[model samples]
Each structure stands twice: as C-alpha cells, then as structure tokens.
Target: MRKIRNSEELLGQGDIASRRIVLEIADRTLDRLDSYRRIRSIMRMEGSVLHIGTRSWDLSKKRNVYLLGAGKACNHMAMAVDHVLGDRLTRGVAIVKISEETDRLNKTEVFVGGHPLPNEEGLCASKKMIEIVDHAGPDDLFIAVISGGSSALMSCPIDGISLQDEIDTTDILLKSGAGIVEVNAVRRHISALNGGMLAKRIQAVGAELIGFGISDAVGSPATGDIAVPYAAYKSTPIGPDPTTLDDARATIVNFDVADRLPKSVVDYLMNAGPDKETPKAFLDNTYFLLNTLPDSCIYAKEACEEMGIPAIIVTSFLEGESRDAGTFFASMAREIQSYGNPVKPPCVMLSSGEVTTQILDNSSIKGHGGPGQEMTVSFAITAAKTKGACLLSIDSEGTDGTTKVAGGITDSSSLKAAAGKGVSLYQSLREHSCFEALSAIGSTIFTGNTGTNLCDLNILFVPAIEGGR
Candidate 1:
C-alpha cells in the first residue's frame, strides 16, 4: 500500500505529534483493511481445491470460470482473484475508476469507468460484462465481485431508460441526501444488472453465480441477514411494485429531488411497467460479504492498540448530516479537554460509516469538496483555539466527492492558519467550499485512489494534557 500523498503536508500543519498519530492510525487501518489484502487473506488455491472463506470449490467439477466485477475496489479485488485462480481462471472483466493504478491481469480485463455517475465508458463496459455472462453455460461458474461504486460503475440502463436519464436521476438522488438503500432501490429498477437482475441473466444460461460483496452500505438491514461465507441464492428484488415505487417516489419528494429529475425519469416512474422490475428469483446464485465498515473500524482500533495508544471506537454506523456530526465530535473533544470523562486524554477516538451533506441551492457556489471535507471544516470551526486535539476525516476510497483530495485533517491551529491567510471558515462552510479552505491551510488529505471503499473513517486524537495547562 502507498502512503497517503499529502501526509507530510497535513502533519506539518497540525499539532505535529497528534497529527502523526492520527495519520499513523489512518494509514494502518487502510493497509490492513485494503480490499485486495482482505480478499487475499480469505482466498487460496491448493491444487484443484479452491478455498474461499470456510467453503471450498473443486476445480475438477467446474469448467469455464469467468470473473466479473465493478467498483472502486474491484480492480484490486479482481487482481487478487486472478492471482489465486491463476491459469484456472478462464476470462474476466472488471470496471474501475482509475485505469492507471490498475495492475495488469493475465485473464481479467480492467475497464476504467465513471463513478458517482455512470458514463459512456461504464455503459460500454457493462455491455461487455453482459455479453460474457450471457454466454455462460450450465457447467460455467460466474464469480461477481461487487463493491461500493458498483451501482454506478456497472451501469447498464434498462430498456426505455437512456444513460442520460440514469445520470440525471443519480445526480438528483446524490444531491438530495438520499441514503444508499433508497438510491440503490431506484437504481436497481432502472438498471439491467443491479439487485438480482444479474443473477437472473446468469440463470437464463444455467450458469452458477456467486457474489463477493465488499459492503460500503453499512448499517443496512440487508447486510445483517447474510450468512458469512455462505452463498445466498435469494436476493431482495427491487421492482416497480406499488410499495417499492411509492417508496422511491416518496424519497424523491421527501428530499426535493423530483424537480431536477429528467422527463424520462418522471415518465418511467409515473408510467411504471413490469419490464422495469428486477427479477426476484434465480435458478442458481449465492452471495457473501467480504468486508464492511465495522470490520475496517476494528482494524483501526487494533492498529492503534499495537502502537500503544489507547483507542475506542465511538461508533461504526455513523450517519446523518456531515456538519452536525462534525460539530458533535468536535464538542466531544472539547469535553474531553475540560473534563476527563468518557476515557481520558492521550486516546484515539474512531468512527466509521457514511455521512451525507445536504447541499443547499446555490447556483453561484462552485466549490470542490465532499462530505468528508465538509466535516473537517466544521471540526476546524468548532474546535478552534483548543489545543491538543487533532481530527482527520477521509472517504475510504481516497476520493471525497469529485475533488482531487480525499478529505482534510485539522487541529486546534487549523483555524488560525486559515485566518492568517484571510480565509473565513464560516464562509467556506456556508458555501460548501471546504476543499479550497483546507487547501489554503495545507490541511487537505490527498491519496490517489486507496483502491478500497468501506464508507468513511474519522479519527480524533486528544493529548494527555492540554496546551499551556
């Protein structure tokens, strides 16, 4: 694993030791919980026996093994699978966001695609994926690598829905602060391969399908029911039923995303047809969760302990507005400084899970930042002038929103540094321009594609004693 590129700059600007500790924890967590490493740890091939978690597959019984995957982490995960299966793997294709960072594979072809929104490249790649799967026979094995951005990266619009329609709908949902469940539900209905539709396609050819899901959708009730190392044949279908469609419509209305939706989207939703429904049943399919947010948080906590720093995971299922959560954590740090309750100083606080940023309508605001950066700025504002506290928030995939930077790291001096540059933190937050504000203070966290996505990670470091005490 590569070091976060902006680590030095970030550490240089904050309370040096505290920032170092926070970065160390973040780097360690990233290293241990990397998607490829996690996959490699659980999978191995010995002669004809292939071991994946607790289950073993005999190569003698299987023929024509094809690998298909998509997501920010699928490149690494696919590479790992190729290494394990070696020549036994027939052929594969993986859609990823970064083509440059992708390692060469013997049998797997890596396709660079768009994220957060699907593009022409993703559409093309998804078509190739469908072609490959559609050719599978009864004796074939289809291993599907699913992860965080798969919904966007593997986009193949269903009939009557153009790529533009999907893009418009996605943009609306993202800006509306809709959760993954609702967003994915809407996507599953419009796409040709989401939900259980992929399984349905493979079943048509009598091929056996298995899903390796690295869950970025933490706290989802669906994840809890899945048995570890067990292949689930049944997947919840997202169809155009009255209940599901109503929920989808309600989400758009509730979030005020309806106005931005394209005419095609509105027409499709309003004039629902059975063709838009994803198949609920499949002949042969199974699923397993490879990694999750709590899994990564546990790794971070363990790493902190290994460094002799007392660490506690405050929560692994954090959600809600990003700024609110940021302010709350900053307040917690201040509380720790003023009083020794809830574990004293010299400890690291950890949290994981996705958060949302409700961007208010501002046509003039052109800010480059994500929810992670927003949280960092909010923390800087609330924790100003308070010494011995450092906080770092990052999207695990290394890209926060559409910005080039991952997120931001800040200390008590962060606000002072921005003030020195005549940067107003409040104005930045108001305009949702955290990227520029943190960049000016040399606090932006930059890591070019960490090759993994398991939600977001936030670390707070409180020193043993306050400054000047």
Candidate 2:
C-alpha cells in the first residue's frame, strides 16, 4: 500500500517534479522501515521451537507464551508476533497510538492509546499489562515489542504521581523545546512502566523476556545483525534504562518548567531516593535491535540511488527549532543551486531527527500543527528564491503533532498559493497553525499509521536553477 495517501493532491501543486521525487523517496523509505515485515523476516515458529534471528527457544518446555507491546508502531509489530505464535500464545496485550482497520490479530487484545501525552485509556491498558505480568511465573515466556512513544502509550505512574501529572509533564517537556532524550529522562523516572521498570517486574517473577525494539532516539547508530541478541539495549519498558533520576531532575531545572509541571512530579523527582531510580541494566533478558533514527536516511539514500538522483545524507542528528531548520534548508538549496557548495542542484538532501517547536504560551495556539508542518511552511516562505525547490517534513509515524496528517509538502510556489487563498503562512507560523495554512493550499500529506516511528524524516529536493537568476 502507498504510505502517502494524498500523493496525487500533493503532486498537483508547486514544483510537481520535485514533489513527486520527494514523495517517492518517502514512500519507499517508510515501506523499508516497516516493523511488521522486519519482524516477520527474523522471527518464526518451528514445531514447538521459537526461532528469532540466531536464537531458538523450546516453547514446549515453557508454561505459557505472552505478547506485550506498546508504541506508535505496535499495531504492526504486535500483529507480526501474534501471527507467528498463533494459538501457542496464551494472551497478548498491545497499546497502540492508532488501531488501523488493516490490523489483524488472533490472540492479542488491542487498545487505542494516546501518544505525545498519556491518557486514561493508556493507564487502564498499562494496569492490565501489569496484571498479566504479576501472574506470570518463571516458566512463562514473554515477547515484548517496544518502540518510540511507548513512554506515553504505556502510562502507569508510580505511587504519589497521577496520570494527569504525566500527561502534563509530557506536554510541558515537548513544548519546552527540550530534546526527546531530556524529556524521556523526566518521564522515565516517575513512571512505573517506563524506564525499564516493567522489565524489572518481569525479572522479579523470573520470566524469560525476548525484546524487539526500534530505537527512535536522535543520533542512535544504525543496527546490525538484528537477529542476534543485542546486549546494549536500553530504555523503554522492556530494557534497562540509561537515564538517571539526577538527569530527570536536571531536565526540570534546565527547562525551568518546575513551576508549570505538576507538583507531585516535581516533589517525587526531587525527593525520590536512590532506591527509586529506574533499573540500570538487565543481563538475563534477550533483545533484538530493529531500526534506528539513521535507518530512515539510509533507506532514503538508497531509494534516491535507484531513481538515479544524487542524494546526500546531511545529518541524522538534526535538531533545534523547526522553523529555523526549514530556513536553513532553504539557504542550503540556494547555495547548492547557485554555487554547488554542499552538492550540485538537482540533488536530494535527507535528514532524520527530532526537531522541536517551542511554544511557551498556550494562548498563542490558534489552530494546530506539529514540528513537521511548521518546518515545511517556513521552507515554503524562504524557498521562493530557488525555483523548483521542494521540501517534505514528516514525523515518519504518520501523525505530525496535533494534526491527523503525517506532515506537509511545500515548494517555492507554496507561499504564492497560500497568498492566493488568503492564507498567511507567516501568521500561521506565529499562531502555530501550519496545518490550517498547508491544508488551505492542498499541501498536507496524510498517511495513517505508517508502521514506523523514527521521529522526523526530512527530504529536500533542489532542482537545477532555470536561468541562473
């Protein structure tokens, strides 16, 4: 299936050739990073033995097999495992950001949870997972599928902390312009399920854990030999947490959100003793690293090569304000087109990372949008100087911020198109309403439940200058 649902509409406007190339690369890259296909390739069942990568487990010797997962990509990951285990799987519980109609599961129960913020439904689903784990014994086997956004999708706050507190904390951290690592640091400390706390619980019961994880952390290295056991896995609910309580406290102080965050969260992070720290390591559990942040760029570069388009992976660690990044891409396009500084024009620049948008006041939000939408809007404004320069910025998980769409695609003509429709791109950025502005110009890209979550995947296509003007 096509990952870009609105490709036809997106291609009809501003720099059609460039938009087509950007969308094509994006479509192929998303398909390559699909967790469902990746999981199926490395896991299967042979008689009573479970084969994953280079390891094999005799289920006949185990009492029961259980599946537990939560994340934006859990729908596909959990479905793959459910199909593999079949009836041998005793029970399964998966909390996903959006449960698609295409999802088919036999024994796994699906829960539609919130992302970017924890909700009551996620809290309930988390409680159910805890119940399942508490009853499990040493003879039981657990297969965990974890990915980015699990921190919010599987929400179970520790004692003295409320679910709303976690929700508020997440919202605050996301808007505070703090990087995802710092935000997760604070979140992992207060949650009962996150920061390897769930793995600790399973370990306490002596249950065997086999983890399939996709690391969305920025600057995460590319994974190799995914079938083998990964000894360096960390974070999420199923692995050891690399973050410390001190890190969490430091984030609060650094972002200066202590007054805005819930008092319960502040008090817990400040006063929690060393015993309250999240698990540092888990030696007994087995883990398989699937995709990382750089995988998106790697796949995109290959796609560009297949299309015979020169492509350069600028950076996999792109960060900072979203609008500024867009402007920078525009400047890079100008240089590439005029002087071929980085690379010649008619080339594609690929980058993957988590770019943030800082909104200090809630009253400033007039409509809705995310970092991807804002970035594309800003690019459209500055890219007018370079003809046929197109940019596509997406969350890569199919949902960009508050909007239902994946992200936005815009080119040099996009700003003019917005003006024709009486939509002010500048005012939209100021109001944090890029979704509305892009939607008016038919530039929004919609792909629901993309089956991957590697944060932002940015593609910039700069066509050769028409007349050197």
Candidate 3:
C-alpha cells in the first residue's frame, strides 16, 4: 500500500521521468517483498499438513498451534499466519513497533513496543512471550516470525540486569557505530530472548518450533566472507554462533563502549559464565529466511531493466560511515557524467545495506536525523551542481532512526535550492541535523511505516537522455 506517502510531491521536485522511474522501482520492490504476499506464497496448508518453504508439518499430529513473533514487520507476518491457520490457531501474540498498523490484526494479540531502543512496553511484551513459550508443551507447535527490529522489539533482560541497563547498553552500541552483527552479538549476551535463547526456551518444554525470518543482517557463506554475486532468496539460521561472545567482547573493547556502558552491562559481560551464554544451537528446530536486502536489490534491478534503464547492483553489503558512503556515491555519479565509466550515464546504480553515523560528542550539536538522511545531505553537498542525477536514500522500514520521516531525496538542484533558502547544507551535515535542512528544500521524505525492513535502499538515477536536467 502506498508506502512512499510523499511520492507525488517528491516527484514534482526532481526530474519527473527520472523520479517516476526510480520511485516505481522502489514501489515494485516493496510489493514484491511484502511480508503478507511472501508468506502466502511460501506457506500453505495442504490438507492436514502445513508446508513452509522446504519443510512441512503434520498439523493433525500437533496438540496446538501457537503463533509468536516480534519485529517491525511481525504484525503483517502474524496477520498472514493467523489467516492461514484460522480457527486452528490456538493463540497468537506479536510485539510490534507502535504504529497505525497495530490494530489491524484480529486473531493475534498485538502489543505496541519501542523500536531502535527498548522500553517498558517492550519489556512487558517480552514477559508475555516468555510465558507463552514457557507454558508450551511437547505436543504444541510454535510458528515464530522474526524480522528486522526484533532484537530491540523483544527486549527481555537477564536476571539482575535491569531494563535501564539494557537500554543504556543499546544506546551506547548504536551510537558507537557497531554494526548489527556486533550489536546483536552483545545483545545476545545481555538478553534472555536473543540468539537461540528463545528457541532454547521453547525446546526446554519439549515444544516444536519453526521460524520464518526476514533477514536484515548480512549473511555468511560458511567461509565467513560476505556472500558475493548476491542471491535474491537465501535462508540461514539465527543464533549466537560459537564466536559470538568473543566478537561481542572485541566490539566493546575495540569501540571502547565498555567504559560508557552501564555498570550492570559491564559486570554481565565481564563475568559472563558459560551458563549465561546463548546456545550456539537449538536441536530439532528450524529457521527459514524468507527475504533480504539482496532480494529487494535484485528486484529493483529487474524493474529498472524492464523500464529500459541499465541498472547495476553495485553492492548489497554496503557498510561504514553514512556521509562517507554518500560522498563515494556522489563521486561515482561525477565519474559517470565525466568519463562515462561504471555503466555510463542514464543508468541506475543501486546499493542496499545499513549505514552508520558517528554522532559528535559535543552536546551543543543537537541535531536529529538518521543515516539515510545524512547520506543524502552529504551527497547533495558533494554533487552540488552536477546535472541529470538524482539520489534516493531510505531506510526500508519507512522510519529513518528516530524521525517520522523516511529519508531524503537529492537532485542536482538540491544544494542550489538549499542555498536559495539560506540553509547551509554542509552545516546541516556537520550538525547531523539534515531533517530541517532537507525539509527547507522540500527533499525530506515521509512514509509512516512501510510494514517491512531489509536495511536501507540507495538509488542513484541518471536520466536515460543526457542533459535531461
């Protein structure tokens, strides 16, 4: 459903045909990856047997079928499961971010929670989920739905560790520029439900569990190197790998987050015993990866080709500082214009991955924006007068960081427009407050909640005709 709310206004600001093509690609990508649509195609009941991906379950043999999930997109996933299970669904619960979509589910009990950070509501929801898993029996089957934001959306602190401690630790790690893998490594150590702990809890009572996940983290190829020549659909397990603890410790020390972490967090990590560690494996359980960032990127590329635009899947594993990545893309655009290298002009260069922002320590720099916005602003500064180029940077979840705005879009005229408004684009980037500056130039994008998350999508569109600007 109209995920990009300001599409008409946004398209009006840039080269119309180019904007339409890029936005259409985004729309089709989201539609192709919609949780409900994907779940329906992948999961179905054939007679008494429920089929999910490459696995099947004999529902006739189960005592009860329960649904449990948490994430920004879990509500949609839950709804799809509820419809599929119908009256056979005994009970269901999902912890979701607070949004207009909260009350849409009828069968599943949906609890509103915080995102990007855990709050009391999430804590309460976590307790309910734990109770559900704790009460499950061997005859029961749990269909767990996990997606992006599940780590924070289902925050259950370990004993002796307060919610405040978990919150403080999360804030420190996020601001410290730790990637999701590293942050989740630490989270698995600190939480009661992360890693494979949830599976452990379910299996402890001899209950059967199967997970359907929309992966937001970069996947591995077993060799530990990033998977290359990205695949549209791939499945992998979720758990605290054997190396998780060591990685978490390294991240904390390497980023110097230990000193700034809460005392409880520090003590837990420092004194973490084998008993407190998340298990590397959960026996007799299975997890299926339904979709991912790479999947969406591939879909976008196919859409671009259908529209007669040569598209390049630059990299699906984009990472590092947001402004730096923006600058790099801006430079690439310049190169394409000047030398016609990198697939020449009139091509769409697409990349998918989460970027980071290193917030300044100075308290006076009170700016609010997410990595996507910062990236767009940075690109605007670098590609100030470049012609026939437009960039759209957005977090797939439709909410970039703490702001309601999804992200920002920048065209060749973006910087000029900002200047006309007497706004300093570079100053805004320096303050990490791009929302206001982008808003001043009608570049801020708004999409309430896209009902999905697969990291961020950055689209660089150069018109098919040279000098289109």
**Lowest-sum lDDT 10-residue window in model 3:** 221-230
Question: Which residue pairs in candidate 3 collide?
Answer: none
Clashing pairs in 2: none
lDDT against true structure, model 2: 0.92
Question: What lDDT is reached at residue 129 by model 3?
Answer: 79
Worst 10 residues of 2 by lDDT: 460-469
Clashing pairs in 1: 232-287
Question: Model 3, range 95-120, lDDT digits (tens) per residue?
Answer: 88855644466567888777788989
Task: Give one digit per residue, the lDDT tens place, for model 2 in 50-100.
Answer: 999999999999999999999998999999999999989999999999888
Clashes of each: 1, 0, 0
Per-model TM values vs. the true structure: 0.91, 0.99, 0.92
Error of 3 at 79 (Å): 1.1
Cα RMSD to the true fold for all candidates: 3.1, 0.9, 3.7
> So what's the TM-score on candidate 3?
0.92
What digit string (tens of lDDT, one per residue) describes model 1 on residues 355-425? 98876564636677888988988998888745768889999888888786778898888888899999998
Backbone collision tally, model 1: 1
